[model samples]
Target: MDYLEYDDYTPGNETENINITTEVTFRGSKSSLSHVLVAFNIIILVVGLGGNSLVIWICGWKMKRTVTTTWYTSLAISDFLFCAFLPLEVFYMITSHWPFGLFLCKLTSSALFLNMYSNVFLLVLISADRCVMIYFPVWSHNHRTVRKALGGIALVWFLSALLTLPSLIFRQTTAHGLVTQCFTSYAGHSTHKAVVVTRFVCGFLIPFLVIVFCSSTLCVKLRRLTIKSSKPYKVMAALILSFFFCWVPYHSFVLLESDVKNHSLDLLQTGLKVGATLAAANSFVSPILYVFIGNDFKQVLKRSLTSRMEEAMAEDLRTIGLSRSKSKSVEMI
Candidate 1:
């Protein structure tokens, strides 16, 4: 993406509004840091691909189509697709060139944002679903079907694709002497600001507030209720914390990138690159979180992988089911 340069420069003075330019100087020298970043991305790509593929297989086919599995399956599919497109990015980072042409460049970049938006949307849905199950168990037990869950997933995908259109539009390959560099070219400074702010608000801020609210409510309710399994709560906490740590740096650096003139361009670039790799690492880290928290190592070893995954996913459902029964019986008293 393009960086902004403010025209009004007064040392130690604050200006309310100022004119800005979309002038950017591209940096070329790949340091040892770039090598390290590339290595990390490659690891993420390999592990994320394998782990997300397993989740997709287990949640999509091995288990019965339920609301929880439907959500998990869609999440896995998003991450899997994100991982599938990482090779193009890894190649570009390694070579400092984009030979894949314009379409693939746009597609690959958009895929990352698509994953970001869709994953956050799914997390919000899962949290809200849990809240409804806990507070209004009877309503959820009767109404929360796989079909309805699929519909919500469809809406999330549609909105994610719509949000991703900007990346496709702004992303292009420009010949930089001997190299073709793929980058975003915003039409104006306001456009750049708009895109960055929108991503922060929509992709990060809103979902974060919703998830936090739902999770807090669920925790308080579950503590007082008759639910026995804490695995679901652990899984939810891990997922939220993982998403927070992984993406917060990326978004933070991205916001810092908006005021690129005040900060050292080289430092911002390096920070952004590192932050992005951390964000990509979330794809693999999620599956590991799910499996690791799902059950003990002994149980995982004793049971088939398929059964283990099924059991992990079903924990929330079983907990919710028991809560529903308990709530109903309490009414009879």
Candidate 2:
């Protein structure tokens, strides 16, 4: 989010360049725009925390363990943890200061990136799982198990943690006049470029490729079959599309940041701020989208909160039982 540059000024005096840099950094503290961003983040914080928390409860505690449930549970856990830290971010944005200690700053930033990576990877796994189920139905029916899904989930977490290590290491808090900001401080231009490239490839590009491939293959396979239920395929498509839309801007800006000398620094900073906000918004939107699309919306709406949760749990258990029966039949055959 820190995109300001004092060195990139229009051919001007040193005094003018310094003034511009000061204006850009301090603008967030004084601008009404900061208030608007903080307000939006607050809304996301509330909704995302509630929605993801509910998903975690339903999938983790109530539902019988299954491959799908395990994935959903992991997704919910990531989103929930991200939302749990939104208050710190919101406070920082609103005050235009990092009152949180340096450790908390690094922890929150690392956690955010960790969640982002884990989410995209988990979605890829889910899409691949569905693709296998659709294209190799017999094989999937016999082989898909909660244990295997759990292993995949663990791997995703480990890789996510590894990927976020740089953020945790590089994030630093520094003060400018009365304002303090927390941002990644690379040792050199090469380090910054390397980090950006790595993030773009691992965090966005590769996962997106896998998602598109799986979704397209699944869609084609579903179309070939005479099944009347295409809603799941539609939901998968929407989820992938949403992830792409939300994250592409953020990654594009990050890449642009690496070569800020070639671009308008002011414009790039503005784009980065907007893109980062949209990307953060995705954490909340995802849970709401999944619940509305993946569940019986009308039924959920009619029941009390507790009752709805109970119903979801019961439904998940029934689904797991049916899946096990199908697996057994496939095995016998």
Candidate 3:
């Protein structure tokens, strides 16, 4: 989610110093585009906050804790925190300045990546969990406890935080004429390439592969077993598709950014701008998909939001013979 920004390069480097003016000019010209981005983010902030907060309330507080609720609540919390910080980004985008101190600059940058990593990791986990449940219902019914799910959630957050360190470390703010700009200051080109590549591999590539494998296998299993209740699979598939569509462009732009010499700078900057906004849109889009897609809107209106959410998160495993004891079937399989 990093922008095309002005770096706080080392002092007294004439060549690098001169580039600052050019960078500022390039950004200033994009002021109108920044306003568009700010508007989009403002909408995301409002919708994301309202949607994720309701999810957190329903899944975290109202519902009895289950493995599914635990995962949903964790995801909601991550999105909520990410949405909570959009005002900072909105302010920066509007003014084209970093009036906030260095701490907030680094914190806000790291927060965006933190949300990305955590969201992707959780999606992978959810897909994998469903794959296992469908394939081994009896075993999963016995073994898929909330405690283990919580442990997994903890591990995901830890790894996400670890991966976000680059943003925290490299982000810097410095005064450029009258405006203070916030940007990343990598040690060298090699370091920049390394960071971008690492982010792609860990944040996007690996999760993508895992999610694809799990969803594909889940589909195959559903077909082989001839199970009619595909509610869980539908939810998981939508999640996979949404994540894929939203994030692929951003990652593509990021990889292209590493080899800036070969790519058009305007293309890269515009791509990142659009892609980042799209990725941020996913935060709010998920609540709609997760909470509203499966339920009948009219019925949901009649019922409480809690009942609707619970129904949305509830798996129709009974139709697939998963809710019953199938030890003999498990043994035969």
Candidate 4:
């Protein structure tokens, strides 16, 4: 994505009538901090991959493989895929330039965000599910089958796919002899701004609001109950807090990037620089959090390694217990 600059726009000021295509510089820092950020980022990427993948494996094996696990599994997959791309970001940070071609630059940005949105979307769905179970009780029990949950997950994937389509269509690499940059060329004159605005609204702002509202509502509702299982809220709270913390500054930095002057950009740039580090760090923490909250992870990585391990073990013992008891009854008769 290309940053837009404004000749007449002032920093920290919102202008409703400003041109959307105005070219702004990304103006981040070039200090020892960049080195430190990248250094830690490598460690984060490694941990995030191991942690999230563990989530998928555990959910797949040790859990009963219910609707919730399916949904969480799908979300984990998205995060895992995104984690796969972190090395690129780490490299770009250290190298201070995108050596990858135009297609990759755009795909990398758009795809990772696709996963990001997918993560938030699934979280919203989970919160909504909890709210239904809390408020509607019987309805949720009758209607909350795995089939229905899977359908919703499918829709989320389809929508996320549609949202990320712009990057594939518009993202391209360009070189001005000495300098190389990754950017998108909008088809129409005004369409670029229109698209950017659309992306901000649909891809980010709308979902963010939905997640915030749904998760907060769920948090409030669950907090009222003194149950052991509702403890998932703690996980939800930490996840949401981490999620927003990582992305807020990135979004703010992007907004500032689109409009701010050099001076303003410089300040926000430092924030942006650190924000990326924070975001990458966020990825790693999620997996570790899963291990703490989801017993499935711990159990699956046990001696048995099947997604159906929990069900199989329960069924096996149930069958053996029933068979022996039946023989005893027959002998007594």
Residue ranges of candidate 2 with Cα displaced over 4 Å: 1-27, 175-179, 296-333
Task: Put down candidate 4 lDDT per residue, 280-308, tens digits, no spaces.
Answer: 56667777776677565556666455645
TM-score of 1: 0.82
Q: lDDT of all the models against the reference?
A: 0.78, 0.76, 0.77, 0.67
lDDT of 1 by residue, 163-238 (tens): 9888888876788688887767677657777888999999999999999999998989987898867787787789
In model 1, which regions exceed 4 Å deviation? 1-29, 296-333
Return the lDDT, model 2, position 182: 78
Model 1, residue 297: what's the lDDT?
24
Best prediction by lDDT: 1
lDDT of 1 at 280: 88
Candidate 2 shows a clash count of 0
**TM-score between model 4 and native:** 0.75
What would the TM-scores of all predictions be? 0.82, 0.82, 0.82, 0.75
State model 4's lDDT: 0.67
